[model samples]
Target chain A: MSALALFQVVSLFLMAVGFYGIAFRRSFVGMLICVELLLNGAGLGIVAAGQLTEANPVLAQLSTLLVMGLAAAEACLVLAIIIVVAKRWKSVDPSVVSELKG
Target chain B: MQTSALVLFVIHALIIGVGGIMAVASRSLVRALVGLIMTLFGVSGMYLLLNAPFIALMQLLIYVGAVVILIFFAIMLTKAPAGGEEERPNQVRTYLLALMAGVLPTFVIGWVVLTDQPASINAPLETGLKALGQGLMEPYFLAFELISVVLLVAMSAAVILAFKRRQSR
Candidate 1:
């Protein structure tokens, strides 16, 4: 495999692992961790594409920067939600924290 | 790719792959967090390989330094069970479903990447911090400004959510 393809594959691996974690892990925090992996995968793929392709490199890095910022913002909000959920529901499991379950 | 570079790339890829699996599959949340740190570190190495050192450093600072610490705080605050007592006898179906869901996308994307190879352009190596800064300041100024606004809003929202929870109790 070419270097670029290898990097892309690794990023895909990260994304797959993240999806599995999100679907299978019961804890909200674990899902959040997995989300991080997914975002990292996205950023890596973007950079790899820019690096190897004819795409504008600066724009690629810029996009990755935005992704990082968004990840940070998302992490902040999710962590806060987890705290609030823990306080109110007394459990961090998604099933236990459900109030709209029919 | 040179022989040395290929070796380095393989090492970093292994780190990311192993760390990703560990982060997802570990029983303990703390161990999962550790695995996530490893993955972040490996990604930064990838950024270095891709000739984006500034992004690599930022990845180290923002992801490994800040986000991981934030997660650690959350883990400490929640103090959930150390991955025990939540198992059910009928969870095999759910596990298989999740595995399929994850693997399907990987295979589809992998096939596309392998078959549709992007033509590599021998562009000048100007992916330095200076270029990044100029791009952010010039053409991407609106986006740069908007990102700060987004971050500010997110920070305030997080603070409000936490404080409101405290006041409710």
Candidate 2:
């Protein structure tokens, strides 16, 4: 495989590892860390696609920036929710968080 | 020619592998976050290898800088009973589930790499930065502005949620 292609494959692996952590991690914080992993994987994929396609480098950069902004916003909102949940329940385990569950 | 690519590929794979393992295996929540950040930095390095330095910088700024720090703050504010000794059920099952989740994507990616025709490596178009600016300001302007509004709303909501409740006694 080409160097670029190899890099993409590794990026995908990193993404899978992140998702695996998200799927199994019990704590909300752990899951959030996994989400970061997934987002990084996505950023790597976008950059790799941009390079391989030889498309507009600036567009790729800007789009990635947009993704980052969205991620930041998401982190803020989720952290708030997590804090509220922890305060109410005294734990951050997702398995026990059932306020919204029917 | 191919040898240099192979060497770089090896180094990239090593960085990603080590970082991924660290992210999954770390015991402390903060340690896990650190590992995740390392993985992101590794991915950004890969982006640099792919010739997208700008995107790499964005990865560092957004994922490592903002998101990870926010998580650390959340951990501190919530006072997560640290040391990672909480007993969670189904240890074996969780590992099995993680393995199952990883299988399909790996197979699909491998298949694509094996069967697909490779495209020639050309000089990337120079209009990327300019076109990106135009696209952001013109086509995606509304969405961009809306994102700002959403962030403001989120910030306000967070502040309100975190405010202390008054005692009735």
Q: Give the runs in model 2 whose Cα sits over 4 Å from its true position.
A: A54-56, A99-102, B1-6, B85-90, B109-114, B117-131, B164-169
Query: CA lDDT, every prediction?
Result: 0.87, 0.72
> For residues B1-169, could you state the per-residue lDDT of candidate 2 as single tens digits?
2666557757767877887777776777777777777777777777666666666677777777778789999878777666443344457877899877766676787578646736635333334556666878987788678878888888888877767563443
- What is candidate 1's DockQ? 0.71
State the iRMSD of every prediction, in order shown: 1.8, 2.7
DockQ values, each candidate:
0.71, 0.58
Candidate 1 chain B minimal-lDDT segment of 10 residues: B81-90
CA shift of A87, model 1, Å: 0.9
TM-score for chain B of each model, two decimals: 0.89, 0.75
Clashing pairs in 1: none
TM-score of each: 0.94, 0.84
Tens digits of per-residue lDDT for model 1 on B51-88?
Answer: 88888999999999899999999889998666642343
